[model samples]
Target: MEAVSYSGLRKNLKHYLQQVNDDATTLLVTNRDNDDTAVVMSKRDYDSMTETLRIMSNPTLIDKIRRGKTQIAKGKTKQHELIEPDD
Candidate 1:
């Protein structure tokens, strides 16, 4: 995460935006008043976060994931060969 003042962000908006996108990082923009503070992040990161949140909100899916993990820990998993598609 990187922090920059409002004026500083405005001065180097392009640079800061590029850094955030390339690094997949969040940027904290601070203003004179705390109420105006904001966070900037790449769209990809934002979408991934939302997807994770959505999955976490489902109880059944979480239970299934936990069961799968438990099975792996118990060495009850099976390995399957990958299937290739015909051209």
Candidate 2:
């Protein structure tokens, strides 16, 4: 793992990309507000993170619609639905 300033990353974008392509290398981007840092890793690691995120994201929309219908059938929902404003 290597830590570089934000300016360094911007200046050596190609070099940083090359390191990112190396599976063993990880980069830390620094010099942002509140001392926050961002990590850059190989595509394999990025894909693994994406898959984990997909698994973690919930099916909230389907659950909400099912609950709404059940509530309506039970007379627990309000009769009036709010209309959205048109742009």
Best by TM-score: 1
Tens digit per residue, CA lDDT, model 1, 1-87 = 789999999999999999999999999999999999999999999999999999999999999999999999999999999999998
Clashing pairs in 2: none
Please provide, for model 2 over 1-87, each residue's C-alpha lDDT reduced to its tens digit, 9 standing for 90 to 100.
788998999999998988788655889899768457788888888888887677557577567767889998998966678899999
Q: Which residue pairs of candidate 1 clash?
A: none
lDDT of candidates 1 onward, in order? 0.97, 0.82
lDDT: which candidate is best?
1
Instruction: Candidate 2: list runs displaced more than 4 Å.
Output: 52-87
Per-residue lDDT value at 52 in model 2 = 65
